[model samples]
Target: MREVAIIGAGMTKFGRSDLSLIEIMSEAAIRALEDAALGDQKVDSVYVANMGAARLNRQTAIASALVDQLNLFPAMAEAVENGPASGASAFKNGFQAIASGMADVVLVTGGERMREVNNLEATDFVASMSHPQAEYIYGVTLPALAGMFTRLYMDRYGVTAKHLALVAIKNHANALKNPYAHIHQAITIEGILTAPEAVVNNPYIADPLRLYDCCPVSDGAAALVLTTREIAEKLGKPIVKVGGIGQATDTHAVHERPDPTELTAVKIAAQKAFQMAGIGPQDIDVAELHDAFTILEIAESEEAGFFPKGEGHNALEQGVTSLGGKLPINPSGGLKAKGHPVGATGVAQLVELTWQLRGAAGDRQVEGAKNAFACNFGGFGNNVVTTVLMREE
Candidate 1:
């Protein structure tokens, strides 16, 4: 396969935006073009990774629609939706195009505008990601399922509620320095712990999980301009190479899993990515983990081999995952602090890692960042995609 490099990465500020889906995605695409120092005329293909423009905005075929809106209508355009991993799926496609010599430069983008719906409507919309018969029909929202799993994790791993709050505190602190992050409020353990006492404080969502523990519904988009290593050299831009990629799937219904604590897909995908990159977890200088919930960040750190099993909480408690810690995770504020707009999440992971590897992340930058890793799990670990990227200078 030909070497693939990310010539540019660009994303919209992930928050409640008044912009429509097309507008948000196009804005990102335009920025990506500028970052790559290329004009719209240079793009060869377009791959979009949005899940719910139809349900959220009554618009569909957003991939082709984006092409026309960006005046790249003649280029090949395709949409990929692997639930929340949709953005990573799009990136995989763009990588294949470059590796196969099918395209020299491709615009890989994903976005979602979800604030238009009320909270209840938004919850119901997100539920559509799982199996209709076994999952969604039971009125299982993502947080409800995650809360159940969190209960299991706590029981099995001896994790405490305080441990989970550490994840939130760390990400929120990191987001404070990220201007593009959705929620930039720096939180304290005392604030989260005491806020849930009164009705105005941290309200309980599902059992064992409160509002602060959950990610906010957001409207956001992120894009990357991908090209071959040769093309990158020709453009004379910083080259962030795609060193490795791995994707795997698991049973969609959470109840059907043999071991709920073991996200088999995540372990397998991360293993493959590490093997392909010829590196271990220790080689990951910086990481952007999928933190859809506070517990997820903890679980994923262990699953990805960044920390030992049953000790993920310990890593966070020791400030090991903080911005200046031994290993920095989610310096972009992650999905928890940055917001989870479903389909846009995975792309945002890569966007953050690209900036980190390029040393462009100002305040939240990991010191001496060289190799970066990202793990994007879709549908509560049912579908997992792990990517390992490197600075190819």
Candidate 2:
């Protein structure tokens, strides 16, 4: 297989958007193409990643629409959906096309305009990813699952609400440096968890998970221009190689997992990615874990091998994961603060890493970052896609 590298990356600001799904995606794609400086080069294929446009926007054939919108009529166009991991799944498909000698230049874009519907409807649309007979029928929202998971993790690992609040505080502070992050408001532990008005300020969404613990439902888009190594070098852009990509799945129902507290899919997928990248978690300079909920960041960090099985919060408390620390996680604010546009999240994570590797991330940049990793979690813990990226010397 030929080596693949990313030449350009771009993303629309995350938050509620007035633009249509295709328009937002096209805007991101154009930004990426311009960043790549492809000039006269032709794109061989285009992949659009999205979870719910048909239900929310009442639109279909989004990939074809994006092609026409971008004036890339003859390029191969396809839509990919894998619950919340749709972005990474589409990226994997694009990577395969280039590696298999089927395409030289590929455009992978992920976008979701989830704000078109009401909050309850959007929640239900996302909940459709759950198992019909086991989860969805029981009205199991993601937060409920995360709440239960957090409770179990706390009991098993000594993580407390304070630890979870710390996660929120850290990520919120980081997001202040990110211009594209969805939530710009600064939060303090006292304000959210301990202050007299805390109960009303950060009300509990689920038993253990509060409003601040959840990622906001957002509308946004992100895009990447990927090509062969030769093409990347010729373009005179920083060569961010797609070092390794790994994916794994578990039981569809959260109750079916052998150990509910263990994110088995994240562990297996991260191991596969590390193995393929010829490195271990220790070698990762920065990482972007799936932080849809505050607990997820801690849980995924441990599962991804960044910390011991029950010690992720300890690492957080020690400042190991803070920016400018030993290893910064989520320098782009993460889903906790960056916004979780389900379809756009995975791709957005890569875009942030690409910027960090290129030394272009303004204030949130992790200095001297060479190797970066990302884990895009889907359907509770059932599906996941992990990626490793290296800045070529």
Candidate 3:
């Protein structure tokens, strides 16, 4: 196997977009090619990750359209969808293409225009990710399941709504410095505490879960160019190596799991990645955990071994997960503030980590970041993709 390196990365601001999905993707793909200083001719293939075009945009076979639009007529193009982890899965394919010597360079992009649909329609669309018989048929939206798991977390570990609110405030503050973040407005600890009762009250989206705690529907795209390490150094771009990658899946039906808190797949995937990277949680200088919901950041952090069992909330309260703290998590404002355009989120996490590892994250940069980890969870912890990235020496 060969070492894979990220030669370039680019993304459009994650928010409501008037442009069609292909248009948004072209913007990102072109930016990536420019950033890599590589012409379209250098791209050997393209892998797209998008979960909603068929239902939301009335589109399919998007890969062929993308290749033609970009005039990459001779290059192979395909799409990958694994619920929300589609982006990371696409990246994994690109990485393997380079590592296996099958392709010298590949372009991986994930884009979604979720906000185009109304709230009710959007809710039904997202619910498709759940099990047809057990979850979707019973009308269990993502937030409703998250609320149930959150209630379990709160009851067993004493995690409070205030703790979850703190996660929201922290991420929003981080978003303030991120020009590309979806929700850049800052909210105070007090603001979140009183959010449930305010004039434009953060309505109860689900029991114990307010609107503020959930990631907004968004439209966005992210792209990355992958090649062998030697090629990257020759190009004189900042070096970020793909040290390790691991993925795992659990029962999609939430009820089938004996323990909702475990997220067995997360632990297994993290362990595989850490082992492959030859590092531990302590070796990671910065991190980007999946924060589709505030509680998810906490749950993923704990499951990823950043904190002890039932201690992730305490770690947050003590500032262990803050930007300047022990391990800076989600300096990109996370899905909480940066927005969660489902399919785009997994690759977007890598974009942030790449920026941080290269010391290029201007205002939100973590000091002395050398190694970073990202976890992209899918379908309420039913599936996950973990990547360990390091600054190439």
Q: Flag clash pairs in model 1.
A: 195-201, 195-202, 196-202
The C-alpha RMSD in Å for every predicted model, in order, reads 1.3, 0.7, 1.3
lDDT per residue as tens, model 3, 1-393: 999998888899998999999988888888787778874337888999999999999999988888888887787789998888998999999998999998888999899999889989988888899999888888899999999989999999999988988888889989888888898788875665754544255667887888778988999999998989888888887889998998899998988889888888888889888998999988999989988889999988999999988999999999988889999888999999999888888889998898888888999999989999999998888889999999975
Ranking by lDDT: 2, 1, 3
lDDT, candidate 2, 187-213, per-residue tens: 999999999999999999998999999
Error of 2 at 198 (Å): 0.5
TM-score of 1: 0.97
Clashing pairs in 3: none
Relative to the true structure, how large is the alpha-carbon lDDT of every model?
0.89, 0.94, 0.88
Over 4 Å off in model 3, which ranges? 39-41
Cα miss at 327, model 2 (Å)? 1.1
Residue lDDT tens for model 1, 303-353: 999998889999889988999898999999999889888878888899999
The true-structure Cα RMSD of candidate 2 reads 0.7
Which segments of candidate 1 are over 4 A away from where they belong?
39-41, 194-199
